[model samples]
Target chain A: MNLALRDIRHHLGRFLLTAVGLGLLLGVVLSMIGIYRGLVADALGLVRAPAAEVWVVETGTRGPFAEGSRIPGDTRESIARLAGVTETGSMTFQSLEATHRDRKLRLQVVGYEPGRLGGPPAIAEGRGLARSRFEIVADVKTGLVVGERIPLGGDVFTVVGTTRGAVSSGGDPVVWMALRDSQVLQFRLSPAPARREAARGPVAAGAPDTINAVVARVAPGASVEAVVEAAKRWKHLAAMTQDDQETILTRSVVEKARQQIGLFTTVLLTVSTVIIALIIYTMTMDKIREIATLKLIGAPDGRIVGLIVQQALALGLIGFSVGASLIASAKDFFPRRVVMLPEDAASLGLVVIVVCLVASGLGVRLALRVDPATALGG
Target chain B: MTGDNPRPLVECRGLAKHYGEGETRVDALRTVDLDLWPGEVVGLLGPSGSGKTTLLNLIGCIVEPSAGTLRLDGETVWEGKWLRPDLRRLRLEKVGFIFQFHNLLPFLDVSENVALVLDMAGAATTDAFARAHELLDYLEVGHRKAAKPSSLSGGEAQRVAIARALANRPRIILADEPTAALDGERAGIVMDLLRKVAVEQSATVVVVTHDEKILGRFDRLFHLRDGRIEDMASRPGDLTG
Candidate 1:
């Protein structure tokens, strides 16, 4: 009705205030949904970005998270000689604590051959690691810029490039280093331990050195499942397709984080719904006497309901706009990535509207029960 | 005695209204009857809780009487049951109501508040606003059209309420203590405005009030006491006697 809109415009300040409050709640919900999607994306990005089709690891162990698996680094040479094996590269994975800009940060160090199967896919700033030993490509979340020196394993390594969204399943930022550096970080023992081992026996000289996981690419037209099964016959190792590796990573590494975020999201949604309901109820109560007057004057029940719903919708819309803007500006400032996808925002807007409508039921009931006769008396 | 001359704009016979039941029962109005014709202003004089409001509510179709027949413009609106289920439509199309407090929606400006009834009656938005503006111009409150109710004086607010009542061009307008909140001068001004609107629009107007000073302005007067119309007078001097 024209009258209702006019009333809302006339009281635009209060209406806007209410809407802004609702928008903030909607924005938070949207960001939460986006973060969940980002988590899945981050976990799959490293595996999916590589063109590899099959992974060879120790038998009966989920490498990269569940257990450590080290095999002879030269296994790649043997795997490359096998039928249907197009290309193969050995990679080492280890988690390390490093100091960047005087801040202690945990990083997942990945070692791979330069310009080979395993490496940083894309660089957002600077250039990808060019040298083999001392250069590193770190995720931008580490706050390390190009030319910055990071202290890791009692040595300073220069940051050559920065990548975006390259985080491990545990949310630790990933850093790509030379294979030798990764192996040293993973297998190098302290002097006390190395000397202690040497003292225990006459260590075999020229023995084969072991490294973690061999990532391989299958020849075009080769069935990945068949190649994986063929590689499984080796008693000392297991083979997995890219998809299976992703599932293992999610289940083994990020399951607890997912559960924690999911619980937080549910709690936030509940709080948002309750906030909307309370606001609608309060606004409706403020107009009870006026509603009775309208009813007494023969305004139809539908008209009354329409007015309340319109106000509720307006509040939700306003709140969502404010909340979305706030989240967009503040998301990156959070310690974790707060992904704000467009579809997620759109869905959140719909949720806000639905919550507003559902929230208005309490006020509508109160309004319908208002006795029109109350408007007649003093 | 109904003919082509058109019955009184409002007619109530043996109208009775009771509240509660059994031991706690109270009679707010008992066996009251009154008539209001077009182009006339009638005053209902009574003290507080004397059934003046009850009679107004009954005529306004807001409250149904326990026993009575009410006719408006020669149409029987109530007998044992409400003749029309959509009383809201009946009110919007046939009757107008004014209250002492003005009761203009505070969130809406003066013009929008006046136009609300016409908008509810399905009039186009432009047409509703135009009618509201025209009525405000008639009542001389057009200058304050864009102002909210709180910004206006008591007299201006009451005038806006009157304009709203007349926006739908109803056949009858019911004013319950319309001047109860104003001073003597403002009350007289409001009463005079009501009289002018009723006569000019050719609509019946009923003013329920305890203000004895404005008794002489009405074409007819009725005295309500103890929930019944005990005294009726065609002239102001009948009460003094």
Candidate 2:
């Protein structure tokens, strides 16, 4: 039998307990990695589904997620007139909370034309939006089913269909409605404010035609960069390629969460390395007599080092395996999506193995320093 | 003791060891000289603090002599240049060591403990275990070959240790108080086994001990007092001739 397995079998309880403890800690680290991935995925899911090669927003703004964009609704018409522009759709997004089933349900209300790029790519249940007003397509997470009616902004809208994985950058489920109806809900004032506005004289009610941004899809053999450059010439418009939108979403919208997760992952890795080193050192200290005897009996230094290193590697492998399994199962309980990609687990496993090798250094040093003379004692 | 020239298996000339420096300098060994023949048992007898174990350690090559030349089978194995890796390999291939405690790996069974020597010697697993079984049977612990060190009685454990030491079939065995923890009967039995091993294996055996009960069992005795040999006398007469 190999020395590592033999040693573990000799102290089965202690070895298993240590491995379980380390595995739990590694599970948290793995979850953090998945959570970060989930944040990026959720942030980009809405931005990418439209299949628009470029987005047009107000100048001096990163995107709708980073800063409010108040581009004129007519910007879509101006952008469509450009060469190689296959389709252009004006869309608006706003976070709204509605009481449904006596529960506060938060959602991102998306305003888009019925037949356009910004509509739901696929519906999970029922039919997508078919009417022009008072009809909605909701994400499955919105907890609303087909044919359900919910009071939203001076109107009770019916949920006509349900879409999966369609969430805003902030993880709010999305609801799709006709552009004109969304404009009324977003820009129209309450009845009391409207009466006060009438007394102040005839004035526009927040300009119902204003939109958040316009998305454009390029024709075949057309360059997204060329379209972006053309759209940028409109002094009041800020145009970005899909890559630019993803960067803004990742580096700004979810930037703080990413940094926090990054810091946590680093701290967890450091703690794991230190804990492994300490465990290995303690084990080596306990076996000083056996090691000295082995040395005195003429076992080579390499063999001694191999014994210590093999045990460390075994510990890391077992711990990481437990951690990965935990993440694979526990992800279902997470409210936000937990995306544990196969490559992520594999990469973390490799890192843990490297950490195991480095952590074995302390134990190897102790084993080597064990005077063989100690075995020939007085 | 020196005899007709097959050459001594172990020879030490002016072997000395000192620890610390300057004002704290303490000599652990001082100007010791000795020769051991093949197929002989040498009892190293000394009072507490007489440096019997120190001398044992020097001969075992666990401690380098401060000043001396140590020759094993007429080849220089120790000088000042122990930093060279060849010395360690020489010790591994040419010497076996036993401690007062059995010191067998607690995780390993008796047979595997014995087979470890062959493993270190790069023997194949089948051959190593076969030789280990043969040695265990020869040592009379073959019945307990599958038992862990923790389960064995003191005598059984020590016998297994002897089997382990003999696994590589080295030319010399250095044992330190191999029977210190055993009672008179077991002690005598262990001493007899050492004597038997020397005769049957044609290997030089040096045992360090203060057990007066087994004194008569040695072919020769070397008494130590204050890091120096006081006497080298043959037991009975002209033994191992």
Candidate 3:
């Protein structure tokens, strides 16, 4: 008979209750990992959507995703003229909050030329931008459907399409509009500012034709590295290949968040280990007398150690299962996308098993020290 | 009548136990020479701190002897140092212990408590349970075999503890105050049961107690005071050495 199981069965209610409390703690750890993964996925979504081979931004700037970058809208034409460049599109990004249906909606507005290479990767509903001036393609997460009119910059735009998983680095859903329309909204001055500008000096002739970055696709037989080097030849423009852009975004934009989450996870696991050790130690102390009795009866030390280890393993595994299940069923309810992969759960399960083994050490040591002669005393 | 056997089941010569050193030294058991034969029920009567329990611990091979040669079931188990490399295995194979309060594991049912000893002895699971049931039946507590120790009455628990001690059919059974918690009638009944077990199994039974009410049950009694055997008494009709 497994003495550990027999003892747990005798105290089934209390054991399960303890496991549930432990499960909740483990659940927080799992969520931290999922949130970290979601942050990376969200950070990379917009960068990967356009599928550009090369990016050209203002000189000395990392890229639009890492920091502010601006270049003449005509930079698209200059990049398209490079030897290996096949297509080029100008793109702009701005984050804004707007009231729609009396509910506050936060969105990342993306500006890309409609017929170029930088539109939404795929349209999940309705159609792409047919009329550029006031048509927008919204991400499904934005809670907008086709034909819904939303006001931005004192102008209303009709939702023409919807996309999935299209979000900004900060986890806000994205919406796409025509390049010219975004330029107008981004550069247009309000009446009061325009009047003040006129009183000081003559206002600029027309809206500023500036875009955040220019993206290029290389021809199949052409070298993307060669195109990037050629683009860098322009003194006012900085160039990067798609891989370089992704690396900068992940390394510079989200590195701190990753480190913070990793630290929190380590602390939580340490706390888990300590808690389990104390609990097992207490449980062992409670049965010191019984252990002495068993020893007096000539029980092998292996049996006593096995009892403690098996119970620790059971508690850890049951707690892990409960935490995993709770997270799996509730991930969608979180404000940020909580991404859970199969390997994540498997890895955490392995860690929990090791933790339990390590935690049972204190109990095992205490049990082995008990003097069997004590049982023969009063 | 059984004294004619060629050898005693337990033999001790110049056995002694001491604690600490120098100014703080204490002797738990003074040098003693003793022999207990099979099929005999003996008692060690003493006051608190008189070392009755210490002597029992030494005889059970749990405590290290300061200066002594000890043998159980014809095998020298300890002599200043352990003669056998594994004293636990020796005890498992040759000796049994019963405690004052029964000490039945609360988590295990009465039957499992008895069967645990057989299990530790490497008996097959089915065979161990069968032997546990047989012992419980022999002890007349078979009806309470399925109940947990917590639910059983004190007398019933003690009977289960006895069944556990006898599970391996050990040659030497050392019980410390086996009936210390029992009433007059129950104490007498338990003593009779121990005597019956000793005679039928041909085992040596040694009990340590201060209860004089059951004094008549032991075939022979040793009075231990200040760690020495001060006197020995053999009841009428019992063989004396």
Candidate 4:
């Protein structure tokens, strides 16, 4: 008879309840890992969606997402004229909160020219922006469908298409609009500011044609490095290859959040180890007399140690399974994206096993110290 | 029947056990010489702090004797120091112990409690369980074989404990106050079972007890006082002061 299994079976209710409590704790640990991955994924989503080989922004800026980077809208033409640059699209980025159906919708607005390199990654519903001024392609996370009209800066734009999983680094859904409309909404002064400007003197007829950055695609078998170098010569702009932009976003944009989550994960695992040790210690204390009797009956110390270790392992594995299940079932309900990968779960399982082995040391120590003579005493 | 085989089954010479040192020193068992033959039931009587349990512990190989030459079944297990490399296996294969509390693992059923001993001795699961059932049947607890220790009456639990002690068919059976909590009738039945075990299995049985009710049931008795054997009786109730 396996004593550990028999003991657990005898106390099945309490054991299962303990496992569930541990499982909930483990679930939080797993969620932290998922959230970290989601943060990286969300941070890189808008950068990757353009599918461009190079990005041209204001001098000294990492990219449009990391900080403010504005170049003239005509920077696209300069990038397009460069050798190996197959296509270029000037795009602007800004976050806006608009009220639709009396519900406030937070969105990351991307302004790109029609039939350009910058557009929604894929159209899950409706169609892409076909008009030059008012049509919009919005991500489904914004809760907007095709044909919904929302006002932006004194003008209303109609949503002509919908996309999915296109969110900004901050987790707001994205909306694509015509470059001219975005320029008017973003750069055009409000009525008060415009009137104030008018009072000073006759102002320019329109807002300056400024865009956050220009995205350019290099031709097949072309050297993207060559185009980047050429854009750098402009003195007014800085350029980066696609790989560099992704590195900047992951390493610099979300680095602090990742570190914070990692620290929390470490602390939670430490807490789990302590909890497991205390639990195993208490369980062993409960059976100290039985252990003495076992020793008196000629049971080797190995058998007693095996009993404690087996129970600890069982507790950890059961708790891990419960936590993984809970997180997988509830991930979609979280406000932020939670991306759980198979390897992550497997790695955490291995860590839990090691933690259990280490945690059972306390119980093993107490058991080994019990004197068999105690069994013969009153 | 006690000395029919001529050779002693257990021998102890100059055996001693002590605790602490110097000013704090306490001798639990003093130098002693003894012999026990096969198929004999011996009883050890002592008051509290008489070192009866300490002697049992040394004989059972669960405690190391301070100084001694001790042999069980003609094998010298302790000579000044332990001669046996694996005392646990020696205890498992050669000696069985019954405690006052029955000490059946509460999580295990009566049969499993018995089978655990055979399992520790490296017996196959099916055979160990089969032997457990057989021993439980012999002890008249076969109907309660599936019952947990907590569910059984005191008498039934002691019977299960006896079955467990006999599981490996050990040559030496040591009982420490096995009937301390039993009524006179129940205690007599337990003594009768131990006597039967010695005669039928040809095992040397040593029982440590403070109860006088079962004194006349032993084939020989040793009265211990102040860490020494104060008296020895060759027959039931026979002693030399």
- The number of the candidate with the highest TM-score is 4
DockQ measured for candidate 3? 0.74
Which ranking of candidates, highest lDDT first?
4, 3, 2, 1
Residue B195 miss distance in model 4 (angstroms): 2.0
What overall lDDT goes with each candidate model?
A: 0.81, 0.86, 0.89, 0.89
RMSD of 4: 2.4
lDDT of 3 by residue, A344-374 (tens): 9899999999999999999999999999887
Best-fitting candidate, scored by lDDT: 4
lDDT for model 3, please. Answer: 0.89
- DockQ order, best first, reads 3, 4, 1, 2
Which wins on TM-score, candidate 3 or candidate 4? 4
Candidate 4: give the clashing pairs. none
Error of 3 at B164 (Å): 0.7
- Root-mean-square deviation (CA) per prediction: 2.9, 3.0, 2.9, 2.4
* Per-residue accuracy of model 3 over B146-210 as CA lDDT, tens digit each: 99999988788888998899999998999988887789988888888788878887889999887
Pick out the ten consecutive residues of candidate 1 chain A with the lowest summed lDDT.
Answer: A199-208
TM-scores of the candidates are 0.92, 0.94, 0.94, 0.95
> lDDT tens string, model 4, A1-378?
799999999899999999999999999999999999898888898999999999999999997889988788789999999999899999999888888889998889999998898888899999998878888999988888899898877789898999988899899999999888877767643367754553464223365577899999988999999999999999999999999999999999899999999999999999999999999999999998899989878899999999999999999999999999999999999989999999999999999999999999999999999998777655
The list of candidate 1 runs beyond 4 A from truth reads A1-4, A124-132, A189-208, B1-6, B182-189, B200-202
Q: How high is the lDDT of residue A278 in model 2?
A: 98
> CA shift at B16, candidate 2, in angstroms?
1.4
Q: List-wise, what DockQ does each model earn?
A: 0.67, 0.62, 0.74, 0.73
